[model samples]
Target chain A: MSANPEPRDPAGETLLSAAELEARLQQIGRERYHSLHPFHKLLHGGRLNRGQVQAWVLNRFYYQSRIPIKDATLLSRCEDLELRREWRKRIEEHDGWPAGAGRERNEGGIERWLVLAEAVGLPRDYVVSTEGLLPATRFAVDAYVHFVREKSLLEAVASSLTELFAPKIHEERIAGLLQHYPFANERTIAYFKRRLKEAPEDVKFGLAYVIREARTRAQQEQVLAAVRFKTDVLWAQLDALHHAYVEPGHVPPGAFVPEGPQEWQASA
Target chain B: MSANPEPRDPAGETLLSAAELEARLQQIGRERYHSLHPFHKLLHGGRLNRGQVQAWVLNRFYYQSRIPIKDATLLSRCEDLELRREWRKRIEEHDGWPAGAGRERNEGGIERWLVLAEAVGLPRDYVVSTEGLLPATRFAVDAYVHFVREKSLLEAVASSLTELFAPKIHEERIAGLLQHYPFANERTIAYFKRRLKEAPEDVKFGLAYVIREARTRAQQEQVLAAVRFKTDVLWAQLDALHHAYVEPGHVPPGAFVPEGPQEWQASA
Candidate 1:
């Protein structure tokens, strides 16, 4: 798992071999990913009140709704059949494939997140509308979309390395939300539960592609920076939530103000 | 200037003529542009301290640096030679034309920003490095880049309608920065000064294009949404700056923290 502990050569000014570059990327995920953010800690720990949690869910829907679009942008830009074939699955996964002529459940992550939104008591239409999510959320998610569309293909693939760290967060979220919030249940947390399986597969393909393509030092650096930028995209969203809903209470004008009475019983 | 005050048609179902759509687009700029953000109020009124000013210059550099890239994305996507010919000038303006094909002091907006960066006392390399800018700045600017790259050609043209509002802001900035800040001079503020001339030309073309192309109500609505999305992109960056550098001071972890001593009376 430790691909290369030291990613430098004797000359020290040039390329790290693929394994070494992978190791460096893992280092970035460890240090910079939003799993370490305080908002996640607060959410997972049952510390945030219902309104605050609603704020998180509403803002996060903005991110969730955009994932397939981001994936499609990636797929559109890839020319190689094999790469496109592999990447196309991501779009199908986030935006579900047509139900096999036999199967009934043909929903995707966005739908699953909406189930969570309903469980959390937000009207489904409002969540879908993304009417009042934080300005920061829109900016952060749109930035991710832009990053995928504009960056080099290798760098675009490299940015998805955040997936390498996502499974752990999903694991923690599944356990934590189930224990901490009454509304959290098998159906409600399905988004995170499904991601636990989906993300590792994604990271496997993405990490290998980045390691294989980043054949030079400049490329390795760009790959690393792309991952770092992706982390910032995730972290900035949490910062916006924390600043607005958590402390000092300075929400920007016209963002979602948490509605409904303070507490909720477990929904059936 | 008021092209059509009422954009709605008698049937209330479809199509705004070109003038009506132009008026609606201008109305968006009037209401939503970042020129209306309070951070700009502080920035132009000389209320921000030196570090805050430096932060604005450095962060805005990320935006200035990407303008040509966004323009190039537009050019790459365009099929029309005449449109590309007109748009190529924008890319060249941000990234200066080739040297000694003619002129002296050939500079792009990026370099002009560095002049402001230097006048504001940031190291040019540091400003260019873009290491310490707010995460929000990256998110906002990247959103604009993505907006240009992925949206419909009509929507892409419409988004640039923000330019229609730019000349007035540049005029305000020139007068305000000069009167309020010692660092302000013709050379340092050249970015704004030049834009006053360039933007009107860009706007003339972009406005005509959006107005002429958005023939359907649905298209007009998309055009309006694109401009509003652009305004959000601009406003979100200022919200990030204000939250971090101004009152209640919860600077996000790892953003630029002002290091310079506070208050400046004419840096002779």
Candidate 2:
């Protein structure tokens, strides 16, 4: 057997020349995001049974719940008003503001996620509390927050470059889930609908921020590593889901488990 | 399938009383710790061929190297000079005083661990650098440092409670390694010999500190959880070892693997 391979040197060049940086960022997402994860394939391809679907929704809700917190962490780190103004929109999108005329026009991504969770038969309170999520998920999510808090702002923004590929994955998920799971309709898929437009705009803004800001080779490498780490965070979540749920009988102790056919509704 | 089972209340009275707390801490070690790990059993039993042993030593040196750092974190957090004095012994034990004619004992636990590494066919430089250890190993070890730094001083002391069980395991390990692995002998087992005497004394001091400090039930629970978390840290190290070296073809990307079999020689 061979020794451990060295991590690729993303800092060989003096500068990534903007276009190269963007391409490199996209390449990382292409090669490593959860969209490429096998569990995601099984999820979007109508292959998993109901129990497996339930497990995915339940586990993913934890991830969904943490997004605003991660974004808020990034918000806390930025010194620029323009950056904060742009980033605060993300938090607002996840937790939308109230509209006038006694109607809330935008109910937020988190609210939409709860509807998706309900479609998969999870209790909204349990989904929101995220007490049932895997330890790996918690670690992975916390690692993202720690990354933002610890790393350079360029790297921190680069970590969000996964958004570069999210729109396509969001579309695939919406179509796949709608076609396969009868319980999942347009209202239940509202999260993806919002993300499809929102992700591209977010990616455009974050990419521009990283490209313009990452001036040194070391900073560029940090950006790449941050993106790679964020990818690992996403990949590990899928790994935990696959190991615990899809592989039946390998569930870790004190992790969520799908109830039997007779007891599913009662457990929910 | 069944729903997720609740964690059983570790069935017994609160380990509030000193004797009961000591017993409960020992029970934690009995249930956890690397001695009970499958990889440890294989190594001590001679079931692992030479290459596996090499990988074990190489990966474990990462852990051996971190003990002082974790202790120093504890020392830094402590406000009382007396407590720091006691904790300083742990640092001194792991990182010996400077060398000279009248110098205090110069070689430390880290040095002795290098001898163990040399016995198992790893180069001292490679062992010291920790260049090729598993990502999971780094995560687990860093998590320990984070625990000590972030948690209450009582919880930090409780994490060190694993030392209370270390003497028994050290004796078992020393006997088993000398009897089973031809490359291992008295010189190589020196680290374990030192630990046999050191661990119990260290644990006595740590337990007293934790018991006196952890007055509230929440604090007590945090202490218990810290031990469990520390146990997970140790357990995760072995898990990485088993996955990389023992279970053929299961090594995750970017981890150590032994080279061609060759006797490691200690050089001046």
Candidate 3:
């Protein structure tokens, strides 16, 4: 992300209070968050047809599936045991716990995303294969994983600060999908539901870490920029979705071409 | 690129002859290259407005500037001194020869691209800063660099096979820009002109290397897939340009927004 360091923002205020920094970060969400994108508006308002919805589900799975990998990448870079232990939860959350630790099976967020994919009439294998994804989607998701791998741990943790804003989107997604699409039963919408429960705990840790670790104005700026960069990652995916599947729609060769009107298919 | 291994192509043919492998590679370029993209058609056919052209030039600078880095990365992975000697030319060609070697200063492909940007009324500093680039552009370009870094040396070399089809595009661009856009002068289009001279040599070596190195059917498949991946990297960039600068264009926030109709400003 810092391939281009932006000229510093012109707020001549020297050091930011934790409260001041939180306000600035939230301000980024208020203005630059993915919810403000037209595609999300089309999505939430029931304006998208079944095909567009299916395209979103298929493409978004790439991001969903990468969550654990990105978290693991972050955890690999952190030396602190506390941070590593907390971060391990993200990997487990997406990838799910393994067999027989004396607990019920957890299929994790990714399998839940696949269930949603099935609801939208896409086969789970096709969604997992990601061969149908827009090159733009792959690029955006990979850039994100790469960002977490390469950026400072401060910036990497800051990137996840978008989660600070995620619960709202998940809430909206839950309501919107249920209201607009026939396929959105509790079983299919489980990913967003689970995220709503998971993210606040994650965000509480991340925001505190970013605010505490930033200690200097420059670090705060990097933290802020990392959040902005993550928004770009999220936003660019929808831009690709809109461009390919929405107005003047030209699905790039090999991306998922929405089939004839989709009928809800239960995940096996 | 291989996060999801594509089910192998079902061709039962054993190993391919050099000519047969070359045919398959050309097939990818013919069917999937950026030249086939609508935005490129708009570009070469002179349908895009000046601002659109500026946006393309600005965003493309990210790709242009990263070439040397990508080449250097490939070289770092390669152990064979002969291969390293051959690959070093790519870095030198893109980065240009240093002055201490008793040669004229060649500011390289990136500088030439900025000249093109300046011809379309962008400032050199701003274009070089990449501040105004579409996040989509950054993602696509960074993904390419990342692929070269992480993938096998054969795959990395294979990715550069797009240069095999470069001459035609260069020829078309030179003639098309000069014929249609007022900004298209020899100085402004110097990048394409220079690449026409440089690419054949690079392609000759890269193509021969890929053809010779892929000794098995599986290796050949990876080589072919690498080229396909390269094409996607390119086509996605144009997809982004069209989405943001073409019809129903909502330039994603933080991308280069085309300005008031451009009047060419000669690079100083």
Candidate 1 residue pairs in clash (backbone atoms < 3 Å) = none
Q: Candidate 2, after superposition: displacement of residue B152 in Å?
A: 1.7
Which 10-residue window in model 1 chain B sums to the lowest lDDT? B4-13
Over A128-244, each residue of candidate 1 has an lDDT whose tens digit, in order, gives 998988878998888888789888999888888899889889999999899889899899999998999999998899888887777667888999989998999999898888878
Which rank order by TM-score, best down to worst? 3, 1, 2
**lDDT per residue, candidate 2, A102-135, as tens digits?**
9667999888888988887788887777766665
lDDT of 3: 0.87
Worst 10 residues of 2 chain B by lDDT: B6-15
TM-score of chain B of 3: 0.90
Best by DockQ: 3
**Model 1 Cα displacement at B32 (Å)?**
1.6
Fnat of each candidate: 0.51, 0.00, 0.87
Model 3 lDDT per residue over A16-107, tens place: 77888899999999988999899998898888888889889999999998988999899888899999999899998899876697977789
- Compose the digit string of candidate 1's lDDT tens values, residues B101-181: 456655887888899999998999888888898998887888788778878988887788899889888888899899999
**Measured by C-alpha RMSD in angstroms, how accurate is candidate 3?**
6.3
Please, what is the TM-score per model? 0.80, 0.80, 0.92
Q: Each prediction's Cα lDDT score? A: 0.84, 0.76, 0.87
Higher-ranked by lDDT: 1 or 3: 3
CAPRI grade, predicted model 3: medium
Chain A vs. native, model 3, TM-score? 0.91
